[model samples]
Target: MENAAWYVLPNEADIETPSLIFYVDRIKENIRLLINMIDDKSRLRPHVKTHKCIEVTQLLLHAGIKKFKCATIAEAEMLGLSGADDVLLAYQPVGANILRFIKLIKQFPNTNFSCLVDDFKVAAQLAEQASAEDCIIQIYIDLNVGMNRTGVLVNEATALFKQLSKLKNLSMIGLHAYDGHIHDSEMRVRKEKSKPIIEILKNLSKELEEIGGRKLNIVAGGTPTFPIYAKETDFDCSPGTFVLWDKGYQDAYSEQPFLPAALVISRVISQPAKELICLDLGYKAVASEKPLLNRVFFLNAPELHVESQSEEHLVLSDTKSHSYKIGTVLYGLPYHICPTVALYEKAVILDADGNIQYWDIIARKRKITI
Candidate 1:
């Protein structure tokens, strides 16, 4: 299997050609690794916010993952419309959006939709909306483990759960605790810090069982915390970037061998000096989180350095004065995979033969209110 190449001259007289290509097989391998990491009963509700593409979502679904965790109602609707039966609007939907929530419930009757709530007021609003529509809406209590982001504290969760249990149309299905602080770098330290929170959840589940007389339906874990938390905690995991590994994750797991499937393909548009070779991809195409690493070494150019980036150009430097002519195609490993993919309008997929299999970017737009 070889990559497709297009020829282009540095001057206007020379015809332009394909510079770089993205391989889909690498993405499949990454997904397979994540699948192998979890148990069969453990629900892999991958977050759709990472790669909001229908093709990627469909690929995951085809790989035996039915449930998905979405960050916005727009992503939920997109996933639901894409024939995904189980979609969880994982964001905290509060204030003045009851009508929109009602409309979504009405629109996707066959889909099993759920949302997160941390406060009593929002829970009441959700219950009210569900009652008005005569719908049974499943709800998850967002617990603030240690991230201190949007969830309610561990002490306050019991009261919220109790209040939610009495609601007519709302069903307290489970607990949603996202330990975003646990990445690959500090997995051990983060896991240690998470122990107390996991204990709290375990105890809370027990208390909820006694109060409601039933087991929690959905105890969820978010991000790369799945591996550590899933083993110690009893909950379904929702890790998004695992499907498309990034440079950050790869660096986090430096001891392990992980392949970054997603890369920004760029062409050398300028060779301003002997040392600096500029590419056609920059901050607009790749995410700016963490730091961009040199992936050209995999393409047989280890001496290259990704020095800096502009809006649409990347500056590559070779300190050793290695000859790099203009029109060179380079692949860049993104620091953060989620936002990087969101920046692109379409992703060109390549097969082993380097032939263009297809282009998919159906879910690239912002979320819809309805």
Candidate 2:
């Protein structure tokens, strides 16, 4: 317990319950580890969806990570706020988002921006909006590489890429393949799955260059597949969770030595029964998308199992017969840090000197002056 007490703050007197705690030292070490993982930092376009704070973005920018990928406009604008070198809005923006994206491009001219397009209609609409705004929008053809979520299939995507090349305000600059479905715990299986996806992207890139007469860039993979893609010279990797890792990834990928930098601080608010104690941590505090026990693992209280959870209360059942008082503090590691991070407005930052500060989770908001 003493050796693994890096997450424990010097004092929990000022912190509120169910709040987020970030260790700057661990985050800095994680950033250093990420930089040392790859040979060339230029090919690294880390996703900013994990820690959506401008301070963290500035940390990455300071650590020499220029290119970044994000899922929302507010994140893009947050990167814009930090003057990131190249930013990719990985999601396909539609309807009013197109204008908001264009506004982002116009607002942050210092930061070059691009987006993903899986459908031709969305691409054309984007091009029309860009034309109306009198600006060009760079895009990547989002490929469906077994994710089966948003990307277009390879066979139809080539023709669509050629078709979109004729559009005036659109520039088909790259091929983006997000193999998010390949998160097997075994490294061998993960490597086996990523090989085919890499081959397809390479072949498609060659075909696009030969036929469309424009060289294309490829940015693919996330935290799960980042290590596999890091070895590839051609494909860039955008891993988000490496910045502030969680229990889910740590338990899944033992090969990745990133430290758990972020945690949720919760105190026991009530003791309803002999073995059942309720903590202030709840669905509103942590990511509740996973199962009851899979959401958050108590770092200090391994004997506690999550019995139930509600909007503002998380009830846990004790097994080891450890006596816990009402105000006992429990530090937790979230299974899914991305969604868990979104629940907090400000992260209680713990520095190396045990100093406590606040950093706004800026991109948690849907709109940040986009």
Candidate 3:
């Protein structure tokens, strides 16, 4: 069979309104496509914060994905408890999370857990906690390639790496440079912009290596610049949205060879006027991060204009004369799938053989069993 322009799930009638539906076959295909793109399984350390479900994590683990990156300590704890081999807390842990991070390391001794540290004081604090528990934790030096969100500047990387090297209980493993800012619509433009950032990371890594007297592993890039970084064999590519592709990235980067694997299944709740209708897809159901016009793309109703949205309802104006029944089901592709997945407690998984299953968003919360 050729590539499907559109994907349809089984048992559409049985699916309830305002439900998160995941195409299992499509998700598997997405994973396969990403692996093929990189051509090396070890290079793909996908982020689990996109799905936050143990079932999805197991699928990746079964597919030989031994390493993963997560944002929250809860996500890291889940991966550790699930027996993940290498789990990286991509975000720098601070405050109480530093203690929680230490607890996770002690809780699962078999699982190798590491974290990102951009600040020297934070790294020192983590070392103090780990030393108190008599545990050693690995940490990557987060470099600011461009995002400027949560990483050390390239010039400041050496000083911080030196400070981290002095810590007794903390091992400075590598560098993590996230280029989330280089998201150009044109593939060529995006790759061209990524070149300088990747060069900065390489230069910083070389400097840190010269000072620390060892080779440093580098992790870089998100979904937008994943294809660009795939060319750099030295960098471990962490692209999360590739697992469940969304319209936002797909539309922006048309050359990306992935399909939308997650969609919001909603039903028409009422018809207030001839051209106006309200859907059960409220802000609570889908992510409302983007502008109102680009919140979601209707798979069935292409001309559906989102007029307004409340907590429990999305008012839309159907420009076309096609009439939809009150219970007519509609599939919506969310612009941002990461936050959208978090809004739901569980997802309705549609498998290849038309089988239906429920997968709980286990790591959606901020806390995990200490």
Candidate 4:
């Protein structure tokens, strides 16, 4: 089907502008491809940072994806609410969040909740809290693995893993590394860049397992290295963006065939100039971290180029085009779907039957009754 046929909502009149719309058929297809990409369905612990809605989580769980990864407490709680089998709180919690993490575990007895640990003090804090509550929280060593964003270096991580194991109420499941920094348009380049880190993590897990006397579960990489890590049996692939893939990954990673499953509907509210049009979609509506040209790709109006954006209005201008008029609807695919999804309270889900329903972006909040 053409982009218009798939992206244009049949109940467009019912929905408001600057809304997040999910094409359920495409999302289901993406999940199918994601599972088929990996050898073991258990190894596919997809991240929930993209589509935090419980409905999407249910779709994944129904598709046989038992394990999941997320960055926030709300995401983990959201997973727990869905009766998720294994939920990894992929971020290292500190300060008050440590207690909140414990509360999540206590609240959701059925869901196995785990977290990442880079600092021993934080692990001890969590262990103390868990011990006090008489509950256990599973943890993965958050390794740096060249991201430099968070996590300890390999040398430190190896020692940290050994130290974290001795603590009570903290289950040392495996090593967790996010190679989100490795999205090189070319798969070969991505593979090449990811090799040393993958090897290091694998060797570390192998050595750690010998000491611990069990299989060390390593959750590694994101959408960019999903295919690369799919080749590794030990590493659990925790790609988040594949559910509602964006223009960035679609344009960068050609090897992965996951279709774009979500879109932002924006209407031309005003045409201030012959070549300038204003949209209801602004930074508040869609993700705005990328440059004006790369923020959102107008699937219908490829000619439209972003000129400026504020909280409530997005201005577009095309030097040679003057055909766009007020009330002209445009479908946009965000450059980064993860953060974009967080901008909305709920999504307008367009089901396979062309019916529209509202699904709360449940985990979008920082806290969810935890």
Report the alpha-carbon TM-score of model 4 versus the true structure.
0.96
Q: Put the candidates in lDDT order, highest first.
A: 2, 4, 3, 1
What local lDDT score does residue 231 receive in model 4, on the 0 to 100 scale? 87
Model 2, 197-229: lDDT tens digits are: 888988989998998887889999999999989
Q: Which candidate is the best by lDDT?
A: 2
Q: What's the alpha carbon RMSD for model 3?
A: 2.1
Model-by-model lDDT, in order? Answer: 0.70, 0.91, 0.87, 0.88
Query: What is the per-residue lDDT of model 4 for residues 197-218, given as tens digits with 9 covering 90 to 100?
Result: 8889878988889888888788
> Higher lDDT: candidate 1 or 4?
4
lDDT of 2 at 194: 89
lDDT of 1 by residue, 142-215 (tens): 88887788899988888888888888898877888887866547667767766876778888888988999877
RMSD of each: 4.2, 1.4, 2.1, 1.7
lDDT (C-alpha) at residue 202 in model 4: 74
lDDT of 3 by residue, 1-370 (tens): 1453465554778888899988887888888888888868898889998999888888888888899999998898879867789988998989998888888888888889999999999988989988998988899988888777988888888877777888899998899988888888998898789888877878877888898899988999999889888976568999999899898988998888898989998999999999988899999999997999888999878888999998999989967787788998888999999999999989998655767889988788888686
User: What's the TM-score of every candidate structure?
Assistant: 0.87, 0.97, 0.96, 0.96
